[model samples]
Target chain A: MVRPVNPPASWWRSGLAVLVVLGMLPVIGNIFRNDSSVSRCEWDGQVMRPEAAVTLELAGRSVTCCDVRCARNWLASHSERPTLIQVRDEHGGDPIDSADAFFVRSAVVTNRANGNRWHVFGDRETALRHARESRGRLMRGDEHPFAGVRGLE
Target chain B: MIVNAYAILSLFVCGLQCAVAVWLTGRWLNSRRAWSSGWTDDGAEVVERNAYLMMTLALVLLGLDLASWPLLYLLLQSYVPSWPGVMCIDGVTRIGTGSLGASRFLPGLLVTLQVFKPLVMLIGGAWLVIYLANRATSKAPLMRRLLWGLLLIGVTSLCDGVCTAGYLLIPKQEDHLAAGCCTQVTSTTTTRSSEPLLAGVSGTELTVVFMLLWAGLLFLLLDSIRKQRSGRKWMGGLLAITLVVAVLGGLFLVDVLSPALLQRPHHCPYDLVSELPESVIGIVLFMAGSFWVAAGAIASFCADVPETREILPGLQARVLFLGLFSYLGSFSLLSVQWCVL
Candidate 1:
């Protein structure tokens, strides 16, 4: 638990602090609604959940989505492909280059964009365990079915 | 996304929640001394004043915390064309997520808080409702319960502080560093190796569990009303079941119902509050029902106190009815949209 907010240093100190906070703020609408050019869930055209966003670098453009499923689906359907596919690692949650990642399809994990039904993992061991548990099929980034996309190579 | 517009205000909000937690805890500790002395009428008045201030401040903070979630998204968006290549909320969120290293998890935590913030609001709202229903009960277990609730928020607010700091640390997203959308972000990453454990539980299974859990909560609500026992047993049962229902129902929302509601295969609880039509109504009903049940139970816990006994039953019944109706009502409406209608 957080320690208590200490008593204000003094009345003027409190006022100064408030002013500083106010000065740093952007417009109020930006606080409540989005103004960025990237779409929330581009696949479904809905506001993306900050928790579930699946981001990929494709076709020299950014395709931000609701989940990995949509990103994967989009990559599969598109003629132009991503130069690099960086999927968020399930364990570390750091975005990993897709070529080095492992994937599982038809798992319980739901995407915010087009419920495409897939998850990405950084290691093969965990992905294999997930397949065993969730009845998912392994999607190896190194393999063709999953890696058919190549851009301007 | 461009430093969230609300980021600065969040510092104050988080500080207030921590302060309120501290104040309430101090009061709780002091109560032992106050009890031993017995409330001299003067002491009683002072305590009452402090209690009222703490609760009111806590509620005010909760209201603000709830509002800040969306603002976090917009703050990034406002950074916009200036950021170049960063077009949407996703671009704003993912850019840092990819480069922020260990702190990348902060954005995910902020989003998960979406499920929890409303619960804090419900707990606070329930306290307000119970306080309105009976003044006499405010002195007993109700105060202790209120302190615990605030403590929960205090702890969570600290997470907010971390996330806010992390957001600040993230440099402006470069044009070459953007990612896809939320679908890719939430599904692909396993923050902890343990995440795979959640797999295999299909959407259908989650839906069944969610409905069953809510049904159990409704049963508890009905029994509380039918017996009007107002004992610890009844109240504890009610509180416990409501908690499970909320937790399970929340998972279901993220995993199954959200997709069904949008008539697509997307899942994001925050979307329920977005531009979607009538989404807020469904969310409000769910919260109303859950909070009402909680409020009624808290009131019941204080029922045995002689001063509050007379008003307890009447208030409990009304509150329970509101909670049960709204909780089930949300499910019904979603069901109609998904299946029945």
Candidate 2:
């Protein structure tokens, strides 16, 4: 049987050099993928999560969380509280005042934009039913303890 | 019909494919004419020269064929991040159609180009297979059968490519076309339950299934090597199985790999390459590795058969090794990114 010919030493050297170049690529990519000036999640400064998008009116400007769960993290970084916060309902996809929405805190269903597994439903029955089926914790949006607790009050 | 560098290169490849078909046919006719006239001096050397020329031309076509997929992907992706869901060539045509406002010429032409691209890619693979077979052994009968097969594929591929030239020549301008993202392609955002692979299985289970499938393909290939005398039929069976595995791997890549790279649930293959250099590297390797698996299987399908039986085992083993290593290396990279990296 004719054995397969082995590639030479220079092949290894060139291969190693190519890997080195490839290794540096992630560092360059990190720089490009991350930008300080773009409006991003206050929690991570990354782009807003599309499905988990929660917009808050706060301090004469808009504050957004890539994930609704990031709302707390954003609040912790700021002293002033938001006057209004709106979260989209998972079932209906209509934006509802966060104070009025029911939230199911679970890992069963995930928001696509942000990696948060929690989903918000517009009503208590639906939220509780989801929790029953998916083994999630049913709670009011304010129960998650964002500054919007005052809004619910 | 946006005539960019990729479009021009595709046209050139189409021309090259046609030229090769003509050349091969011409060579066959000349050989037959010479054979009927009885023995001729310098025939062997002339045949040798022709083989070298064909080898060079086949390699060039194969390179173009392999590159065309990624090239088409890259050209269209450059429009994305601004315009999403334009992953397929036809989706790009949709964008053009939207921009031109009720014009059939652009979309009609681009869609035709899309149809031809895959046909040509299939023929290109056949060309590579035939070239490899010719060099593998001096079995004229099998080569004759394979060449006939190539002729059918080549005629269709060439005709399809030629049909798109009129559409490609039109100048297309990019405009305010709000091409949909994956969300639009999919009716709802939470349609995961509808996916065939994920229908009854959890994501973790799907991952395990894919790993086992890949391992099984490797095991089968190794076993085929061990039983070389009886392996030819088994290799054909294995090829059918590997093709299934490759298709499943592609689905998994679309469903899981893209999302893993993005660190999010909703994912696009085009976006994976555009967003991360690592993703592009990993996916390119994965695809190339899988192709090699299919190609190597095809090349060795009839290796254990009589006539060329003595000459094919070594070639099969070598090609299989290339396929195996490529797949292993690519998946290893993917695994790292998924879990650790």
Residue pairs in steric clash, candidate 2? Answer: A49-A66
Encode model 1's per-residue lDDT on B130-181: one tens digit a residue: 5655455544645545555655555555455455555545544332233566
- Name the 10 consecutive residues with the lowest summed lDDT in model 2 chain A: A3-12
Interface RMSD of 1: 16.8
lDDT value, residue A41 of candidate 2: 58
Model 1 residue B14 CA deviation in Å: 5.1
* lDDT tens digits, residue span A1-153, model 2: 854433334544664555455445555556666644444554433465455678878768877776676676566546667788888888757888877888787757363333466778888889899988887897644466453545435
Please give the distance, in angstroms, between residue B52's alpha carbon in candidate 2 and its true position after superposition.
Answer: 5.4
Q: List TM-scores for all candidates, in order.
A: 0.53, 0.59
Give candidate 1's error at residue B298 in angstroms.
4.2
What fraction of the reference interface contacts is present in each model, in order?
0.03, 0.03
Put down candidate 2 lDDT per residue, B1-341, tens digits, no spaces: 44556667756765665565556556545544554465467664454455455445445545554555565556554433223323222244455543444333666655665666655554455456545555566555364445444444445544544544444454554444354673222222211221334556566777778879888987876554444422546667777877777777877876677666654334345455555557577666665555655665666653234655655655555456556555655665566555533
- lDDT, candidate 1, A1-153, per-residue tens: 752222213633653554344323222323444546545565555566554466667655777666676566666545656677656766667777767777788566564224456767878899889888998888654542346565623
- lDDT (C-alpha) at residue B232 in model 2: 47
Using lDDT as the measure, the top candidate is: 1
